[model samples]
Target: MNAPTVPVLQVHQLTKSVQLEDEVLHILESVELTINPSESVAIVGPSGSGKSTLLSLLAGLDQPSSGSIELMGKPFHDLSEDGRAAARAGTVGFVFQNFQLLPALTALENVMLPLELQGARDAEAKARHFMDEVGLGHRLNHQPGRLSGGEQQRVAIARAFATQPALLFADEPTGNLDSANSQKVEDLLFKLNAEFGTTLVLVTHDRELAKRCQRTLVLDNGTLVEAAHASTGA
Candidate 1:
């Protein structure tokens, strides 16, 4: 008999809230989820539904107010800030809506940054390979300011996957792109995801984008539920 595979991410009663003037605003409440390795999942909802907040907690970028998060079988929620950073060093990757490329760096340098940080001696070679995979090899010498929105996003994608992380988190990846560019980025994102066997968890308001994932989740009023179709509002 084969051994059962462990889930890539697990959450239990996750919650987040903030203190306002004489009030406590709840952002998330008792969110429960499990994601297996190599699965593609989307989280969508209305504005102020706390989608991005949940993503941050799951990625261990921020601490939750309550509940535990297990990422890649480690107690992510229990770690200190620096410990969490250590955990994500090579195992987790992220692609954000605003291409977070260093403006001064060339496309290839942006892609190579993470690899170099991880002490990979062949950072440039790996960066070049993924840059070519995203059809951005020709623009490697160009800086982010010199590239179009689509090209910048493609560069971000290359940077994310260059680390070959076990999991990836994308926050409204196509939010800043036009329709045509959105479609192109979506294609490249899924293509690289499949090739790398990386588990994907994304937050998008685009219904079509959500539908492309194997599973869709809805976040509403600080709660989460499985969804057959994602709502395209806000």
Candidate 2:
């Protein structure tokens, strides 16, 4: 008999709202979710459906108005902004829609930044390994300004995985790419994710990409629901 796996993320009664003049705008309401270790999950929804908001909250980038969020067994919703930052350090990785590379840094430097911040003595070596993993090893000397969008994004992916984070969150990772680049990045994303055995939670509008994950969660009416399968209609 095997022991039950501990969840990487747990949420309950999650809600977020803001005051708009005299009206209170509700972005999320009583959402419940759980993700086990090494699970690949995708959250998909239309624009303004709070998909990004939920991702932010889950990643500890923002706090919800009310709820409990346990990230990696820590009380994420209870932590202050700085506390959240400290908790995420070295434990979490992120990939944003816009490649958030420093313009002054070369591709290798960008990948090495996080490792250097964590005081990893062999930062350059680790960065090089991941850059090669993403097939961007040849572009290591190029700066973000010189690299193509696809190459820059591959650098971002390598940077995200360099620290070997236990969990990763990506928001619209392929949104800015063309169909061809999107496919390539998608393939690389899943390939490295599996190799590293990192738990993945991504927010994207691409249904095809979502289907590649183990589960697809749909954000509807300010809450989450499991996406129905079209093949079996289950």
Assess the local accuracy of residue 126 in candidate 1 as a C-alpha lDDT between 0 and 100.
99
Inter-residue clash pairs, candidate 1 = none
Alpha-carbon RMSD of each model:
2.8, 2.4
Clashes of each: 0, 0
lDDT of 2 by residue, 158-195 (tens): 99999999899999999999999998888988888788
TM-score of 1: 0.97
Give the Å error, residue 142, model 2: 0.3
lDDT per residue (tens digit) for residues 1-234 in model 1? 988888899999999999999999999999999999998899999999999999999998889999999988779998999999999988899999999999999999999999999999999999999999999889989999999999999999999999999999999999999999999999988887788899989999998999998889999999999987643411
Query: Model 2, 162: alpha-carbon shift in Å?
Result: 0.3
Model 2 misplaced regions, further than 4 Å:
230-234
Give candidate 1's root-mean-square deviation (CA, Å). 2.8
